[model samples]
Target: MSYCGHPGLMPIEQALNAILTEVQPVTKIIEVALIHCLGKVVAQDIVSFVDVPPADNSAMDGYCLAIADLEKTVDGVLPVSQRIPAGAVPEPLTSGTAARIFTGAEIPEGADVVVMQENCSEHDGKVLLPPVLALRDNIRDQGQDILKGSVVVSKGQRLRPQELGLLASVGVGSVPVYKPLKVALLSTGDELIEPGEPARPSTIFNSNRYTLRGLLQALHFEIVDLGVVADTFEATEKALIKASNADCIISSGGVSVGEEDHVKVAIEKLGRLNLWKLAIKPGKPFAFGDVKGTPFLALPGNPVAAFATFLLLCRPYLLTKQGVGNITTPTFTLPANFSRKKAGMRQEYLRANAEVVDGKMMVNTYPNQSSGVLSSTCWGNGLVVAPIGQTIEHGQEVIFMSYSDLLY
Candidate 1:
């Protein structure tokens, strides 16, 4: 896409699809206990053998009785013939009886309706159901949620806490998931220094290393830290060789056109380097290729650019490698409280404070849109997306995405 004055830039969407097309999900799969599989992608479809609830059960604390008994009983009342707590089996409801059943208690034989306790009155050992009630009013039927032989979770689904609970509900104790990707992370530049170490002359602490580490850890990737490599073709080539065994080698910086930037050249010398200027505001210089058969993704040196590109582009690529098919992020349409002076040819993400104001979701832009302003990323809830050549007018409806979202 021709991005404004920058002529040879690729659209961000096109770049994302291209990167995804070149990568494949890890082939190794392992079976783990359901609890351990939280946040892990399911490698295959999981079919449930047992139905959720297994049998008809009470959905609330109430009285269970035959529907016919409810319509014809005197004062819609019946004697409490039994009390069935959750997990307890019960005898059949007698000709004129009601069983006291708590939530999750199996429905007794011959009982098809449950009257919530609030809808019934108890006096002299008899419970009176409301005059109006229906069959199975408060009963959760067997297989209502899941039937036997049904797929509980399809392949490529990331198992969350709720997913774990759902698997347990259907008697699934273990899950098959793809092995976590082994990622070798590195930072480049002679000016980059490690944290807790004294900085000599014109050096700064390596923040991207730790930041990327935390982000990748949250995504469950096994990280191999190659530390910071000095800005030299030999050093860069050596780092790539050291990390060649990793599934993906990720390095921040040294991929631009700067004469001192040697990572791109070193990668080309050892393997391949396809560099592209992405049509994005903060993130433009992006490199994606392979080194010794292992995929490599290089982000820009700017901190904010690295953050934005990792979340928008590299994060999705990692998820795809884990066999996740639906790796898109959530988004919403909201009003923008700020205005843009000029429209840029490339799509832009403005970090901003998103809050519910006057019963509407509104985002006010963070003043600093600089690539180095990591504070902007922290202050804003997510990105306010302005499409190509689209300038924002105050109160205009703009697309908002949470830091957690993958743009669709």
Candidate 2:
């Protein structure tokens, strides 16, 4: 399973899918308040017993009157029978009369249609309707948007603000949803310092922790941070032990085979490390395995490498393991604005800025494409994915993928 002449490695996608297929979502459900259920996966389909807009109502502030009432009007004036504002029930409509109903007000017992106030003039105790008006106009029907005993949301659907509002309209106070995936995060490097600490000449501040943490939160994960682990075997083993307790463990910096790196050996000693040297630039070193059945994803030490690996492999895998379907990174074809020299054996993702100009989509890579540079990612909105060993030319079609499309 070696890749690029490296032992103990496999293709990235194959390794990810293998682990994901073996793991299943924690098949437990909890009733959570609808207010806090946004971005959570629904455990089961939610069927509503009550229909939305239970009764026919006006969709706007207008007059609710029978079609026959408009026929007898000699001029534009018709006598107003009653005024029904929103949330109030009106008495049955008397013959030859109209009721003033506000938006969302239930239709009266005998009214069939609602006429907008703008269609004609409204004077003292009188409403005017055009002669060409049709029946049942401007009225919201019962069960129009959602029906009773129908599943409004399917299982494994992520709850959003609009979904919550829809469920509330059907009188659902709470919903059954899966718990957030608990991810253990840590950084392993003796030369790395915390953000607030002063860095020595050869030392750099730890960036992976914050980067991964932010991305994990965006994916609705509950993070358990193990902080920084020194490169020593003892400290690294202890950190791995802490990470093994979580549902999944993610560590950066020690997965590579550099002499100073020791995460791979520690992972093997503690549990397992299925190394995957993917044919992808900036994210070749990937590790996946389990410790006592808890999954572990060991990413590379380079900042861009870690980000790319997480987005391409870990993000979709985690989502699928948590009961999410349609787990794939979205990509689109856009014209390349710059030509670059590339000897392709591996797929390369160049940081690029995309814009639709003159009804055509275009992607232009930034000048700096360093693996360790954080500014390259910040300055670009998406990635230009060039296939394995494929050199791209200016104005040529290229596949572009956005970070937002991958995580959220």
Q: Local distance difference test, per candidate?
A: 0.87, 0.83
lDDT (Cα, tens digit) per residue for candidate 2, span 78-112:
78999999889789998888898899999998898
Q: Write the per-residue lDDT of candidate 1 for residues 254-356, one digit (tens) a residue.
A: 8899999998888888888765588898889899999998999999989989888998988999999988878878888888888997998878888878898
Judge candidate 1 at residue 127 and give its lDDT: 89
The predictions' CA RMSDs to the true structure, in order, are: 2.1, 1.9
Clashing pairs in 2: 1-9, 344-389
